[model samples]
Target: MSDLFDLIIPPNPPREVMADGAMLLRGAALPYETDILTAIQTIATRSPFRHMVTPGGYVMSVAMTNCGAAGWVTDRTGYRYDALDPESGQPWPVMPASFLDLAVSAATEAGYPDFMPDACLINRYEPGARLSLHQDKNERDFANPIVSVSLGLPATFQFGGLKRNDPVRKFALRHGDVAVWGGPSRLRYHGVPKLKDGEHGTVGRMRLNLTFRGAL
Candidate 1:
């Protein structure tokens, strides 16, 4: 004897989904998405996002910026974390409290408590922009988990095995989804495919990703 509305609604609440050692917290960031976006704008104002060139002398399609004690950067010297912005010659903008809280909360929910990320990398992806499969190993420690939050346009996330050639599983990452990876799967290859054409009210034709890491 259930009502019509009850019959159409899901009985259980959304929960975290595990992929190997990685955990996907669906819709976990929805509540703080607006705040996160505001923080991004503020951070961008201090440190404008720009497309960085790889050591191989190729310009990246994804424009990126960072905020925290340490920021990831690349150039002829290769990938590494720096305290000062190479572009501005000043220290990277401070990590927003909202960004830190969301990252810590997501990691805690994924079973890694007391997570403190020293770096928050913000990546902006537009239509036709993509990131190839790669591991997050630039950090000094592999024990710390990487928490990534997604906002705006939907994109297909590729989570692969330890090796680049290993089989990959595609996950549709929508707005407000948070993905955490550590432990045994810390070195697994992961990347996003080319974004499709779409216009989100807030982000327009772009997808913003916040990846928190312990880079010190």
Candidate 2:
């Protein structure tokens, strides 16, 4: 496996440490690009998109939705995880096989096998959009790792530590990239910098991020 990986993704970037608990695996999901993009398109139709209000009373810059048994949400109350989509008062759209397969395969490739994610957050960022650094602490199981896939235009990912003021590492994530971290890195803070103006043939002037997790 070591030899195979070296041959495939030669010179895997330094495993850049972003914080005490965060690391970046660049282009980790390039091998499964097609399946991930198809999955995103399939789920978008059912759940659609909407800008969610943050707890701070400001609306998020990105449009978001979810698929799977649980979904991540933000509103006047604050950010949290829920089993149903607040918009329709129904369960978030089911996780497509394509999505699940790609996620598991990516996770497995990252040394995490048999990963079963029950929540998949789909975030779309247009030019000038950004996400604040925050921890993914809403899941019932902190033991489960996070598998995040990037598509469309590239964006700089800001990975931080457990605290807000912690130093952060920026990763320029492009289409077909996957980032996976867990164990000691599960609670690290992360976000995306403002997306630059650009357009892709399929996703247009936007970047899509699919984050898979096990939300009780």
Candidate 3:
């Protein structure tokens, strides 16, 4: 297990990757922290945190919510998107302007201009929480890029290739970092390792991750 992360991969983000797809734009959200936080607060009011159960009945350590045209969900039936929040039995919270703007901007920079993501998955990870490596293939369209924004306590992100055993790259994402990927890299597997216990001035002992995608 240690060998899986032994490779101290550097963040050698290439310009072409930024122009085509799959690029890490460090600190892209730093300037918009206030706006993003406000958006999060608004969404939380509508769709509060809930620990979703996986198909295996294991409770996910992360609490999640969503806002947009569609929202991602995982249950005994498997991972899928629904227009309404299953918990509230109503439509998911509306996507805030700030969230939409960031997704669009990040996608455009990654060579998918005019991108307007209709699904946003918000995950809140606390100490010891980790996301298993998996592909974001449940979305309806693979052409649309995935834009992820990181905030609060730092976490190690595992970015792999199309194949499960493909060499993986790691990066410590801090608040305000944005990762955008699509095109041939849209199906790459990725996840986060267990988060160490630590508190952030704004987010406490947790990490916030926003994933924007096109669902319809």
- Write candidate 3's Cα lDDT for 119-173 as tens digits: 9999999999999999999888898888999999999989888899988888878
TM for candidate 2 is 0.86
> Over the stretch 1-216, how does candidate 2's per-residue lDDT look in tens digits?
999998988785444444433445666666666776776677777777899998888989999999999999999998888988898888888998878887887677666786799999999999999988988888888777898988899999888777889888778888877788787878888899889999888678899899999988
Error of 1 at 146 (Å): 0.6
As for candidate 3, its clashing pairs are: none
Ranking of all candidate structures by their TM-score, best first: 1, 3, 2
Error of 1 at 181 (Å): 0.6
Tell me the lDDT of candidate 3. Answer: 0.87
TM-score of 1: 0.93
Point out the worst 10-residue segment of candidate 2 by lDDT.
13-22
Report how far residue 166 has shifted in candidate 1, in Å.
0.5
Q: Model 3 shows how many backbone clashes? A: 0
Which model, 2 or 3, shows the larger TM-score?
3
Off by over 4 Å in 2: 1-23
| Candidate 3 to truth, TM | 0.89
Candidate 2, residue 89: Cα displacement in angstroms equals 1.9
Sort every candidate by lDDT, greatest first: 1, 3, 2
Q: Can you write out model 1's per-residue Cα lDDT over 1-216, one digit (the tens) per residue?
A: 578768898553356555656899888888898898998999898889999999999899999999999999999889999999889999999998888889999999888896899999999999999999999999999989999999999999999989999999888899998999999889999999999989988778899999999999
